[model samples]
Structures are given as structure tokens and as C-alpha cells.
Target: MNTLGVTLVLGLLLGVWAQTNIERPQCDSPEAEEAALVAQDYLNAEHTQGYKFALNRIEDIKIYTKPDGDKTYKLEVELLETDCHVLDPTPLVNCTVRPKMMTAVEGDCDVVLKRVGGVLTVTAFKCKTEESTEDICLGCSTLLPLNDTTALDFVHKSLASFNNFNENVTYAVFEVGRMSSQVVSGGLVYLAEYVVVEANCTEDPCVPLNDAMAARGICTAKGSSIAHSVNCQMFLTMMPVIDANVVDVNSTVAVTNSTSAVAPALPPMVHVHTGSLSPKLGLRYHKLTTLHNPELSGLLSAESTESDEVVPVAPGVANSTAPADAGSDSSNSAEVPVVVKKRDVPIVPVVPAPAVVDPIAVVPVCPGRKRFF
Candidate 1:
């Protein structure tokens, strides 16, 4: 062979050897190292939530070089969570958070991450709204047998909107029946804690949710007649001035029950239907009439006056005594006979005669007519 041919063959062999060495390092180098570090940090963070995400696999390395001799590599990797599992019962009100950690760079080595197994997402509240509030301590005195299942849910019932401050909270209260030896017709003794629900009125400030009013009726089962109720349930209707703790400082809800034999009975106003009128009864007078006399009736009518002399009693009338003066002597007066006419049966309250008294006895004991004080 010629000297030139031998030289050309050696140069080609040297070029191929250099290409193989450069490609070997490109498959695994600095960029892959940095990605591995990031994956490690992510796994460490996942461990805090009781899960461990470890790198499963990596592949597909491709290297490219520019005129400036700058090289880049592309790759893929897979990962999986090692230990923890989460179960979610409700999806709407719950959220799922998953660990996300992966990075890519242009350099000698490239790392690709592929997720091997599915992640078990733990469910939690992303947002919760405040609904209502109640002040049960004031009116609730005794506990009653409560059917816990009867309680209504705020969201499902649409009773009231929850405020932003009352999210992700669980609260409850108990009701007891009053104990008494007396056999009351209805079970009257009962106590309950008042719960308050505020309306999320950002849209309609004046009104509350449709279920707000009906909600309490369901809670206490007392619609309009707390008077007959052995138990009462009430919900706060006012928009209370909330404190830093999201509780009302001065606002309260009033609870009432009728069958209670407790110290504090239902207020009198609650019994207004019973027709209690002592306060106004004193202002009225009893009406009286006597044989409907035309003359006496005339005096009560629009025309007669005291100056008009009273007529004498009729001849057949048994009570013919003369009309006495305003202050007359009655001991010397003779009694008059009264005759009562009977009805198909008999009449009642036969009008009594006006009683007369001696004027001198009632007057202060003045000295003899001639004497001076």
C-alpha cells in the first residue's frame, strides 16, 4: 500500500476513537447529578406526609454539540411513593395534594423521571364556609334524650351560608329533659344549647338562606307553638358583631318551651291567647237596670235633669216610698215590699232597692247649733 493511503486510514481510526469516548461521558455526567439531587430533596419532603417518593428509573440519553463546542443531553426518569396511603370519602369538600419534583437541564448528562405507581392523595379541606351560631346556655337548663341523627347539615339543607371564619370546624351540644314527679300530660322539662348561624349575605345582605328559618324548626322541632313544646330549638337571626375569635360578644338567641315545670315558666306574653286582662279590667263598670223605668231611663237618656221633679209611684205599686234625699235618715223609713215577676222559669238579680243612710251620723260631730268652735 501507498504511504498516503496508510496515513488516511490512521486518521479515520483516531477520529472514531475520540467520538466513542465523548459519547460515553455524555450519557452520565453533571446535569444528571443535579437532577438526582432535586429528586432527593423532593423525596425528603414527601416523607413528612408519611410517604416516600424514590427514583424508579431513567433512560433515553441524546447528546448534541454546537459550533462553540457546547454539548446538551436529554433523558427520562421514573419515581414512586414507597409507604403511605390515603382514603377520601367526600370529594367536593376535600382536596388532594401530591408531591411534584422534577427538573431538566442542557449539559453532558440528562435525567428523565417517570412515575411508576399511583400516588395515594390524602383528602383535606381546601376551603370551608361559616354557617350559623347559637347561644344555648341562657335558655337550656336540663338535658333531654336527643336523637343525634335528627340534626340537619348546613350544606345539605341549605339552611344558612357559612362565613369564611367558620370553616373546617366540628361543633355539637346536648339536650336534656326536665325531671319531675308530677305526671304532666305532656313531657315539659327540656334544655338545649343555642347554635348561631350567620348568613353569608355578601350577595343579598338583607336576607338569609332559604333554609335558615326552617333549619331551627327542624333542630328544636318547635315551629310556632313553643308553649306546647317539651323542647325548643332556636337560631340567631341577627348579623352579630363578631370578635377576634369569630364569636359573638353581646348577641344571644332566646329559647322557650311550654311543658316545663321549671322555676322559670313561659312568659305571660306567651299565654296572651288565654285572655288575661286584670290590668285593663279595673277601668270598666257593671251595668244595672230596674224594670226599665221610663222616668229613670229618661234621666239616663238625653233630656232629663235633677230640676225635673220625679213622678209619684203608681197606685198598684207595692214599693211606693217617696224618693229619699241624697243624704237621708233610713232608720225611721219604712220597708217597701218588692214583687218579682217570674219568667217561663224564674228571673235572677231582682234589682235591689237603693240603701239610705242618716246624714247626721256620717257628718263630723259638730257642737250644738249655737256653739262655736
Candidate 2:
């Protein structure tokens, strides 16, 4: 082929390669996604009882992407309650300004960003009454006291802890897989995207709230970090679905209502023994070996013989019963003698037993059996 033909073929191949490599951006900017998340958060904030008047107003949308690096955008949101509300302005709610971070999900092409509220609460309505019921409750304290940076830090720490889990355990695998896949990598990424979008959704401040159900804080204990709080609220709560076999009325009530009642007083104590009881102590147990066990009862009639009883000797006393010195009287028999002889008894030598060694007996060699190595 001619040189010009070769060059044309090479040029065509290069163009195809370039076209395949090109990666079109999914959204106009990462900031747009963050705006959406802030908006959703604001809507959720309105549903909480005291913070019913809280609303989010997007102040600015800024997109930043490092050249050939992950794209990030910041959504500056203003969170405030209207004149009708009386909730204290916390760092999370009733505050005038808040910011949420958003990043593009690495692979997904859709411009839509997914978000998860760091703060979450669930409540159940009981006949739409003003009275409180556990059925309609607020929860998800895992999200409390955390902002963008702290939330991300917590997520990273969780991922690290999962990575350290042992692979041999079945439960560890399940835990690690669930956290790393669902919550850590996938859920967190999507959540960050949602935060960005929600933060930019609207410019209206203090979105009106008709009536709210409850308010709550979400606090999660991540690895090595102290529990953090995320302020949130909810309009409805979901009840846990329990199986019939798993629900035990009596036992479960005891566990759930530990603080329900005060305990009764204990009975008074009585002293029985007057003299030294010695606690009837030691490992020597008195056995009732016969039908009428007299040994167990220490009590006896006044005429009972005490002659055969042995008395314990005091420390450092000579106990020999040999006849006392010639001048000693009968009363001196009860006293220990200090003039006892101190004799050194001769030591008996221990003879060494003979060591039995095995006899070296020679066996008769078989004819023609030996061979040279």
C-alpha cells in the first residue's frame, strides 16, 4: 500500500479510540445536585413539631471539579424558622445558614442525585389525637450532631472498621458486605449527591408548615468517635414487624418495663448464736451417717463425759505427758513445762536404690544375612 493510504488508516483508528474514551458529564454542575438535597432536608425539617416553621433557602450554587479528579459542589443553604415558631435555633435546625456537600456518583450517568438524611425520624399516628403514643414515635438518632465533614469522616471510619473484620466469621462477612456495599460506598455516595441537590432546590426561606407530628435527634456511634447528633423530625412512625413465636408477653414486658415499679423491702435479720460460732467453717462436713445422727448435735447433758476430749495446745508449748519433776504438785500438771530437754535426733540416711540398666545380650547371626553397605 502507498504511504498516504497507511496514514489514513492510522488516523481513522485514533479517532475511534478518542470517541470511545470521551466521558460526558451527567449534570451541568455538582452544585445542582447538592441544591436538590438541601431542598428535601428543608421539607423534612418542616414536619417536626417545634421546627414546623423551619425552611431552607438556597443562597448560591458553586461547582468545583479538580482537573481529572472527582467533582465536588457546595450548596450554601439558609435554614430558619418563621415568626410563628418557638423552637431554639440549634446548629442543625432553626439556624440561619447551613451547607451540604455533593459529589458525582462515579459510574452512574443519570443527572439525578440520590440523598439520605443524616437525621431521620419515624412516627405513627394514633387516631389523629393530640395525646402521645409509642406507636407514633420519632427515632433514628444515628444522624445527630453531624455536619458534612463530620458525616463523611464517620462514614470513612465505618468503612475502615469493616475492613478490619475477620473473614472467617459468617456474621462478619454479612456485616462487612452490608455496610461496605449498601451504606458505606453506595448509600453514602448517593446521599452526598442528594445533599447537594436539596441544598439548591429553592430560594424561598421559611417554607410554611401546616401541622407537624414530632421532632427528634439522630445520634450514631461510629468507630473511635464519640456519638454525634443530627437533629430531625418526622410526621409518622413505622412499627416493628414481630413474628408470633418471637413475642413473649411476660418476659418481654419485664425487659421493656424495667423501671416501671419500685421493689419491695427485704425482711429483717436475726442473730441466733451467743458464743463464738466460728461459722461452722472449713471443708470438714458433719455427715448424718445413721438414722439417729447424734454427732451432728453438739449439745449434751451436764453429766456427759468430757474425759476423752483432746484440748488444743497453745503455740510454742511442750506437750510431753511424762511425770513432772519430783516437787511438782497435781495443779502444776495442767501447766506447760518450760524446762523440757531440746535433743537433736540423728538423721536417717536414705540409701540410693540400684539403677536397673538393660542387659546387652548378643543374638546369633543368621547365615548369609549380613550385607555390606
Candidate 3:
């Protein structure tokens, strides 16, 4: 073939390749809307802790046709927080968007989807929320609206921790008045200022005091998965003053002096036991067992037995009861005492017992013997 004929064939192949691989901007159509909906569903499912998001609008869409006749959709979509929480079984279409006055959250997502055998599948996605963007720009601390889902969650967690430590009264959260959050190296920290009222019921769905003079208190809580602290103060009326001294001069030179005394007392304050209770304290027990460490299991069991008492275990100190050798003979295994110590106690090293392991049974075989079943 001549060089001209070869050049013509190469140009034709290049055109076909470009048409197959090149992405084309597409107008808003049903296909684009369908892709956006699918992406929205994916986002809502991935987010399990916060309020569910509904598709606000499709920002942009690009379609690419592959050589195998498959199509790829690259989309940018806006999402708005809905009134329903993620845990709620309500569908995103049925959920209504939360208003801005209620601290509504909005997010934008870049989603990539591909159609294989006429089925749409999300290939990749990236999202950025308005709150997160602001947080990153502002750095560290950020103010949160009381009605925000995350803020409310922190408020509830603080109240729960407070109730767990409180001995006399079981209080219920009356209102989440104010909240702020900080991003730390360990986790997010929430500072919540709220009001609590004495509750008639003890557990969840608690009934607040119904009396006209029901006791109310103001509480401030700073908490995270890493640590928790709270302080609550109750209001009280001032006592009446008492006159203790009086002096009177007789006759025309009559002079009088009086002295009044009032009790100097501050309102009662409730301070929670910090660092003892966690938002996920209840779940830690299962995790400790899942670690499969006998020392941890023993420690947990001991802690449960003395749950009423606070025992500080030194960090970086291995348990004295842990087995020295994990793979050892079962017959030689022996029980060891678990030593619990206070924070200031000196570290002590103790020899540990060998771990128990089951022996495998071996099947006996005769040489040159053939068997059929």
C-alpha cells in the first residue's frame, strides 16, 4: 500500500478512538437526572450518623461513550439536609429539606458513574459540605447552631453522661441553647450549653417534672469520644436578712444604730466525673473481648465487678496476667493474678504463664496400602 493510503487509515482510526474516549458536555436530560438520583442515594446510604440529604439540583453532567458501547456519567450535584435523620427509615424523596433558619446543611458532590450492561454503578465520588468547608477555613473551633443535628447529638450525649454520673436526680434535656465544636487531633470536641429539668422517669423518653415549681438547671458540657466533662448549676432563692445589733441613745441625744446580716451562699453546682464515662463506653466491652487478649478480658471482668469504683490503670504498662508465650502447651498453662493499681503506683513486672493451645490429631497410614470406599 502507498504511504497516502496508510495515513488515511490511521486518521480514520484516530477519529473513532477520540469519539469513543472523549467526554462530551451534555444538556440536562432524564439520563442526567437519573444519574444524580443514583448518586444522591449513594451519599445518603454512606452517611449513617447525621441527617439524610436530599438532592437539591444537578450542577453539571458529562457523558462519555466507551469503545464497548458502555457510557460513563460524570456529575456534580447539590444536596440539602432533610428533616429526617439517617437512622429514620424514610425515603429521601419523602423527606423534606430543613430550612436555613434551622441550621440547614448543604453539600456539593462530584460523582462518577458507569453504565455496564444497561445498569448504572457509582465508580467514584467526592463531597464537601458547607459546614466542613467553613470549618477548614476557620480552623479548629467553629460555632454550631443549637438545632443542628450534630450539635443536638452532642447535647444528648452530654446529658446522658451527666445522668450516668448523677446520683441524686435524673435530669432530662430541656433545651439545647448553644453549642460550639472544635476539631482536635484525636476527634471532634463539642461544647454544649443547655438546660435540664428534673425528670419523673429514669430512662429514655423521660418525662419531665410536671409541677409548677419544677427544678431547672443550666448545664455546660464539653465532650468527645476521647473525653467528657460537664458542669451544672441549680438556681435557689436568697434567704431573708436578720438584724442582729441595735443601739439607742436616750433622751434628746437619741441616736440609733442597726446591723443586718444576710447569709452568703452560692448556688449548688454539679460536676461530672470527667474521663470516666465515654459516649461509647457501653460498646467498648464487646470490643475488648474481640481483641482476644486474656489480660484485657480479665481487666474488663474485674472492672465490671468494681464498676462503682474508679480505678486508674497506668498507660503503657502491660498486664501482669498476660501470657508470655502465645503458642505453648495447654497442660503447662496456669492462672495468674491480675494486679490493679492506682495512677501513681510504681510499675511492676511479673512473669506471665504460657498460653494454652489445642493439639492437632494425626491420622495413621499403612505404607503400600490402598483403600476404596
Candidate 1 clash figure, as a count: 28
Let me know the TM-score candidate 3 reaches against the reference structure: 0.37
Q: What's the C-alpha lDDT at position 21 in model 1?
A: 14
Across residues 1-373, which tens digit of lDDT does each residue of candidate 3 receive? 6999878865654444334433323324667778878888877777744457777776555455655677766566667777554544556677787554434466656565778888888765555555423324433455564455666665665565555445456777665444668777767877766656677654436777876577666667676622456666653321211111111111111111212122222123332222222244222110011112222222222211212342343422212212111112211222111111111144443422223111111111111111110
Worst 10 residues of 3 by lDDT: 282-291
TM-scores for every candidate against the unseen true structure:
0.17, 0.15, 0.37
The best candidate by TM-score is 3
Which stretches of candidate 3 lie above 4 Å from their native place?
Answer: 1-17, 21-27, 132-373
**Highest lDDT scorer:** 3
Q: lDDT for model 2, please.
A: 0.22
Task: Please state the error at residue 70 of candidate 3 in Å.
Answer: 1.4
- Candidate-wise lDDT, in order: 0.24, 0.22, 0.48
- Distance from true position, residue 327, model 1, in Å? 99
